[model samples]
Target: MQSNHKKRICIVTRSLSEGGADRVASLQSILLNNLGYQVFIVTILNSVSYPYKGELFNLGAIKEKNDTILGRFNRLLLLRKFLKSKKIDIVVDHRVRKKPFSEYIISALVYPKKTIYVVHNHAIDLYFPPFKWLTKLVYKKSKAIVSVSGKIQNLIFKKYGFRHLETIYNPVDLDYIDKQKIESVTIESPYVFWYGRFEDEQKNLSLLVDSYNDSKLKSQGVKLVLMGNGKDKDKILSKVGELGLTDTIVVLPFSSNPFPYIFNSKFTVLSSRFEGFPMTVLESLACGIPVVSVRYDNYEDGVLKHKHNGVLVENHNSGALAKGLNLLVGDEKLYLSCCENARKSIESFSMEAIALQWKNLIEK
Candidate 1:
């Protein structure tokens, strides 16, 4: 029999915005709640208005005025007080500090016995001074450190000399995906689809656009479909126009649910320069869609096995990405084979299996 006392699991993040960490935290909360745990979400911002089916209680909201130095200190004090009063069983901290020094300070002050710090990125090279020291301190203080990718885990472990880091690949709700029947939308034209933000530097969108325009695939009916909004959208769109790809390329705003388009597209493409286990790739595979990605991280290796499950391109090379896309689109048998393999690869990442993993972690 399950214990009557609900395990109070508190998830602390910066906000419930439409980012990968926010999505992961939300999914975790839903799964934990289904497992009979009382899930509390603590955030510093208050822009979230999306209806969450799971039971989630928000702590006192902090205004944007608290974004300054003293404001951050006050927020930390408020968090500490809240933790003390709530008597949370397990506190999962997912805050990626804007300033590295604050990481150490925050870790030192928030001394919850059962605290888990989740590392979501591998690009810690940009971390500011005192931040490195703070990160090390937090790593030492954390009861457990969870990395979204093995690459991230190895990087952090090597940097901080922490030996017991755990790698948990971001999970996808496969059941929800399976329920989404492939829509009967006609492919008006054969095209390669890229459904993520136009963050050129991070997503390597510029490289993707240049490569696609240069490729022989462009002569064929293979246009590039760009989706998702970001700070760099206008710049990226202007570049697309400059390349005379305005007709060949389609730019879309961000969607709360991108599955419908994913289901109807020829395949999914990821042009990221770096990723800590991309949620888009997992979500695409769960929808039984083939993917073409630039291999920059170890997690990409797990998802796209060259031409087996999906195509893997050389990092920062637009030519290789374009060639890979062309090969997949040209070969009908290969396209079907890759999509089938992608669906199978995502079986382990199903919600039930991931939820079981979470349950084991928390119960242990």
Candidate 2:
């Protein structure tokens, strides 16, 4: 007979960073903890940026400072033994694996069952060659598969022939964004904001900078502030300088609370190559800022409803994006219309709403 008590749950993440998935992982743990579940966050690394309301286990901290063969094996064994002993009801796996071998091995050993893999990308393109096939096979070991957006679920079904999959959009902690008033780090200028990891390949920041440069918006003294740091920061920054846009464009490190900037800006912008569902767009809407973004593949399927709430460029061309940006921000009536209807568009993605979905999945 099942005990009438809180079910123990664990969320496994690589680390907490500015990445959309990282935010989702930490937010889920906090939500579940608040929902009165026995929650645990098992992070592979110690660099946690977000605060959570559950027990946190930093696997990195337990291992010896010096890397010895035996020490590494012992740590792995310890992790497996610990989880087994605790008898976790479920393990929510949120790490995106670039390679299949290690993930498959770990799942077979530590997560043989009762594990749910949360896919957070345009899954098919993120992999290479035969490993993609192997990765799909590895996912079979999980108790269930969840896609961050419906588009990802469709891709997985078509490619891997998976029968069942759940599409759960990333949740926005509305209470935190609403109540955490930021009195500091205010952007006085009426600017168009863009914030995300500085990585260019997937995020397509190069296109955003070029499009911003191509547009005459910068001439109006409406600054373009790009937030979040990554390995590609210096390269993107150098490009910003090369295009003679250092003064017009600004790059800032990720802020713990970016709502004030989003709420005050003329509108927010994005130019991602692809996204699992785009937390930035959802967060931007939650803050009541109209969005302007390229119509990446998954863009249409989620967050962006075009013209209704935000402007969507037809293609990724700089000229097209520039024209779209100028149209959205330059036209007073259109921007006002979008801003008025912004928050209403994403009410379904509120933290509480998404948490209900997760709760249903967990209890099922």
Candidate 3:
């Protein structure tokens, strides 16, 4: 049933395209809309790659037309007007608030009292200002600060001591994923998949290549598929070429629906140096495909239960990652076991479960 009074909500985000957090923001719009709330998505950038359900206010388009200082100010003014005109009861911000002054203007002038800031990374500095006082002031008028994981929440509390903090795991739309996973892809090889932005610094695609090269999967006729676009696409491609595994390692463009690829793969892998609850891992598991990831300290227990649903290897160790990858590929019994456990393991992160949490937050 819908809430007694249908509230209007505006999800503030960088873009509806790319990035895990942006995807979460898009999903929230869908969830809220389903719950009978009027949802408006306000994106700072014009990049719209992900699928969403809501009225979108693309402020970037206006900025692009003028591309002046006054245009930027006008965009802010227009944003405030949009919220006022829509009578937005709640503002869920999912953007990285790096600029303190800009955030100050936003929090103090534009956003409503019930605004909730989301911290999407272990690197809290990206979401919260470097200065504690500024960080507190920027979000002081807001209702709560939401971190995507428990570890991220603790880190924020420990560092900045923000009282109004909450942890909401990124939700996976299993229904949609299940539907998409059933769709056919042309690839015939039994390949392991890694899909996301090709940024080497954060994603550590170098580690992914090195580990894959060192693994036995290549010799066993299993190809490595790297999917998605980013700043380091050329660098990653060059690395793959240097290894002379281009034939075995295929690079594909970003797909709005990656579930089909995930569904067809042997298993998915994550070799990130750091992450804040990667959606790829959750989505793969939801697709009934097990994951192999180098252990990042902040990863939630339910996301990867080591031998239960996915393999979590030693942090930053390519050798350990390779072994973990090989372990799943070589041991047919264990791979099957992990695959069987994968979908059920992430039940807590389902849309219904996470949406309930959001509902309570919004209602209260």
Candidate 4:
């Protein structure tokens, strides 16, 4: 909180590319930069598609060139030296800490006491390894562990008994959305949208296809637009073709600026098996587009309101999701009401409000 103290913060994550957690890191860089902080980003991977306002240190380039054991060790040494050279005041780490030994080294040698680990999924082991003692040993020394949902916060506590954990939902970058939403798109037909990787396990891409096939939206001439890339693209396309809904279902690659498409869509849908707090859902609501998402256990608590802002399908089954799609698109009055309430529903999650929480956390 002291003005005399330099606000030099650096974010450590996988990449500033296509992923919900990665996108949040990119937004944080912009938010911190706008607040007059000296911001820097250190991406473990070289992939970068999202726009960010900070200097980037791409460690992935080194690993790409030489992926030997010696090269990996060198990357670790260089990461530590890079942080020290920048004299980073705070480190907001968004990387998935899967390997226990690597995390131990990073926690013991690389990161400082001001580091904050952000958990972005319900799969707690992805962020904290399965070993409870090791998880506590590495993470307990940090400033705090932040989860994007209250459910994840509780899971962390119940699983690991960490008292320093807190929940900070993903903030929607309204200013950025305002600028991006106005970009022109060539799509003519009104479509329901879903954008993310084509992975079938986590994102449940087949559920999206099956539900769309069963929904009346296609019969009523509302198209389904899917935007993203992954391993299951061919499988998803094949399923769509088999169902004879290929023409009705439009599949496109991921877009860095997807707001224009989202802004013009009738609504958005999320069928993910689980998520911490998806950026797409927040971005959809921020774009004044209501979302119809399949609810996962203990998730969607704060973000999705059942009928006020969006429809939360009671179950993850394809039939339930199909019914939800029909209800939201079938009932004109409900659809319009949700659309009208969408933007305001997420006002509390604006970048400024969430940034204030980050500022408080850093100062306190």
* Candidate that scores best on TM-score: 3
By TM-score, is 1 or 2 better? 2
Residue pairs clashing, model 2 = none
What tens-digit string does per-residue lDDT give for candidate 2 at 1-364? 1223487888888777678887889899877876778887887766678767678777767653635767766766766876777778889888765555555667778773788888888855443224656766766666778888788888888887776588888988777887653444556676899987888888889898889999979878888988898889999999998999888887889876677788778889988887878888888898888899898867757777778788989665899899988998788888889988998888888777887788878777
Q: List where candidate 1 sits over 4 angstroms from the true fold.
A: 1-5, 49-61, 124-134, 180-189, 299-301
**Model 3 reaches what TM-score against the true structure?**
0.97
Score every model by TM-score. 0.88, 0.92, 0.97, 0.96
Sorted on lDDT, highest at the top, how do the candidates line up? 3, 4, 2, 1
lDDT of 4 by residue, 1-364 (tens): 2233457899998988888999999998887787778889999888899989988899998889999989999999998998899998889999998887788889889988789999999887889766788778878889999998888898989988888887888888898899999989767768999998888888888888888888888879999999988798899989989999977999888889999999999999999887788899889999999999888655556578888888998655788999999999888999999999999989999888888787778778
Candidate 1 per-residue lDDT, tens place, 1-364, comes to: 2335587888876556556677787777777777788788886567463224343445435656556778778877777787777778888777675565566566666647787878776674532224566566566656688887777877877777876567777788876666654544334557767766567778888888887886766687777787777788899888999999888888877665677778777788887877777788888888888888878655443566877778887875777877877788888898899988888887888767777777777777
lDDT of 3: 0.88
**Residue 243 Cα positional deviation in candidate 2, in Å, after optimal superposition:** 1.5
Show the colliding residue pairs in model 4: none
Q: Sort the candidates on TM-score, descending order.
A: 3, 4, 2, 1
RMSD of 4: 1.7
Runs in model 3 lying further than 4 Å from the true structure? 300-302
- Candidate 1 — what's its lDDT? 0.73
Q: Considering summed lDDT, which 10 consecutive residues are worst modelled in model 2?
A: 123-132
